[model samples]
Target: MTMNKIYSWQHKLWNKLTHHADSGANALLLKGRAGIGKLDFARHFAKFRLCETPSSTSEACGTCLSCGWFEKGGHPDFYHVSPETSANFSGEAAVAVDRDESAGRIKSKKKTSQQISIVQIRALSDFVYMTGHQRGRRIILICPAEAMNAAAANALLKKLEEPPAHVLFILVAHRPQQLPATIRSRCQLINMPMPDVVQATRWLKQQGVNEPEACLAAASFAPLLALTFNDQRYAAQHDAFIEQISASRKINPIELAEKMQQSDLPIVVSWMQKWCYDLLCFCLTGKVRYHLSRMTTIRVLASSIENKALAAFLRTLLVSQQLARHPLNPRLFLEEIFIKYATLLDSNGVKRSS
Candidate 1:
């Protein structure tokens, strides 16, 4: 099928990756934020490589043998490897975010939809080594790249060093730092910018989200995530989380994360991020993005947090985003984060902590 609805930026990225798909480049790190169409870009790029028709700007004529298999997800030559845990989730794009459970929550079922492991890597490698059932190149896609452990990463590296003929590797990640530097260096790095407010708002509208601006502000401009807070379910959750933040400056970020493990992390991060973003606005211009929605709330919250505290708060939030990549102990990290948040806010005279 014609890629009639892809974002413009994705088009440019697709062309860049396509150039290497059929050439000497054996491995490609399709890097980007959760949204910004990274997965769609990769899927379409792989499709183009498998495309029967290769145009200067696009790929796959949609009528060719390659396109048909792709449409059916039955292509013998191509394999998509991602966290088995996230498999059932079918979004236009798939993103990786922090997974939190109580400091000692029940262990995640080693089920197919949770983590990307060495087993999955091994299975794909076996496929890539063997002959393809089709005439085209062999393609393997591993997404949310950070999900792989050291063992899995190394397994992938061994193959990267001695890649099979006609075999292609596409790795996608939200937090590339969690990936081994060796693994990252093996492929071309493509940065997918987070969609701006305008693009995000437009996408939200298309999704039939009411009060798109609230969701946009809630997501801090991340479109793929904007869809989550676009509804009442998420809106109420957002408000509840914010109240938790407002009530206790000593926030247990990891605890919160663990409590809402089955819930969406992007939304949690969005709530926290937008809170700081509002402080940012108030510090800079004394107004929040959605004055009609959360501006009043932010204004009251900001009154308790001056510029110095606001800056520190945002810095901690940024650091928390980085710490989130350490899948080692999500609970401790999150709790400590809120303690620090509470400490900072308390220092500024707000009893936001327990």
Candidate 2:
């Protein structure tokens, strides 16, 4: 349960932030792409602010009483807000409740919510308005802030509009645009930095990742996500999915959909999106961004794919991505997308095996 330490790429921003630690801005927004460690950065900054004695470099002293409480997840003055179903800060996978059939009785389990609720926001009033530990500064961190529903966002807006004394709000968002304009306006927005390929690849290597470059590219250059690519199970799934999709003439949409229905829908959609993106990219620029290991296959696929149809399918994938999070029938949802893709290839004269 160690605290999230600052990464090498964050040194410059860290110094600038710590230098302006008391700039009188009650609310700060750390907006960036996912897997760039925005949440970790926010957590580290919060720990530092609450530390009784920070280091010369403006980092939290790990041995301080405040740091101990923060690390133990019992800091009285610090509150973390995220979706009920999110494992955003815990560095774990969120598990969905499964139905139980025991004692010859069927029990239905309620699905965990993926959106922050108004109740969660209202509950923050007590912590925000109350005195801090030893009357020191208090911090409220909301991660993936866009998860707040409309009502919850409105409740939080009231606090940001008239923030209490000695309280700071740190919002980490992967898609800040999803947040309301007023909420964005109330905070001092900072676009979190992204590491270059060289820096990212170096860090991944230090993490003992094999084929770091390929993993990095597969994650669209997001280094943290590249770590997941190192997982053999996940890597195998991605490779198999890509192989089936690449051979459009041999794809069995229904069977593929059935096999993938048990997997994370949004993630599967993202995988397809990346593969199709490479195909489209190859068609247009004589290059492939992702699927570098399958360049020969991508080149052949790109040659037969109609640019207009491929582009249209890519747009369709965007809508699919949005609906993926809460699909009523996962199999049907995937089937529809895969069927469309098969039809697209068929229209391009990709004949199926007899």
Candidate 3:
């Protein structure tokens, strides 16, 4: 769909960006947490910049020829770079490489790469150096810029260093720290804003999402991700996972691991992380963050565990999150974490089943 307007939370940032649209910066880094509409904002800005007749508010004129080309995903001056397995600007998918089996399975029969290769970066040489449609300014949008491998990142760094005239590079990264320091320094870094709970819930309601607050918390306050909580498959899986984990005393780590082996490991680990975070938060501050509906269970569990032990477990989850992406055995990986969690609870006087 065409991005005609920015999100409500983004109006101020939009004004700030448009006010300096002609500042002559060739590259921009739109970095922030995932699912907050940074990509949509970038698309809107690019459309505005390419519009032959922009509005007084610096918005795209939908009727312009440039706007038409952009909406059709065939703009001569617009280029998008993403991992081969990702959806392109036109919503088309491609194949590349498989980094980790346990990181998450793509579900495709053909293995695909999750990285933006050097070839894709080098391919931009033609688009960047060539003449644009009607000789207007060109825009290159690279989303999740951290997905670029070392070679690809270094290649893009060169272009950012000696950027061609009349071209803008917009790099959108959920984890900007993962991007090289040299690459980050070469562009205009824009820290995208996060919508507050009220605004995010309102937006989700406008999108017809029920239980917006709980969903919002489940997604760590990322509205777009919270939207996925409405999906039947994902919701069922997440609910089941949480329910089983809540029964720490009776949870069979091996069985749970087998049941969720097909799921994304990093995501499963994150689910555990959020659950533990809430448990710890309740123990210390008497409040819950993610599992808003499970206050009673969290309260009971929090009282059973020591703050120091829970905090240490939380730190281990951070390391698990990293290795989850490249684990050799997904089942064993899951079993190990679940077992540790059950043991922690058991040690805290939570009786374990035989």
Cα lDDT, all candidates: 0.64, 0.78, 0.80
lDDT of 2: 0.78
Off by over 4 Å in 1: 1-5, 15-21, 53-57, 85-114, 193-196, 248-267, 289-292, 306-310, 323-331, 350-354
* Best model number under lDDT: 3
Residue 160 C-alpha lDDT in model 1:
89
All candidates: CA RMSD (Å): 5.2, 5.9, 4.2
After TM-score superposition, the amount by which residue 296's alpha carbon in candidate 1 deviates from its true location, in angstroms, is 2.4
Q: Of the candidates shown, which would achieve the greatest TM-score relative to the real structure? A: 2
What pairs collide in candidate 2? Answer: none
* Candidate 1 Cα deviation (angstroms), residue 47: 1.4
Q: What is candidate 1's lDDT per residue for 182-227, written digit by digit as tens?
A: 9888887778766667776876787788877776665546565556
- The CA lDDT at 326 in model 3 is 45
TM-score for candidate 3, residues paired by index:
0.86
**TM-score to true structure, per model:** 0.78, 0.86, 0.86
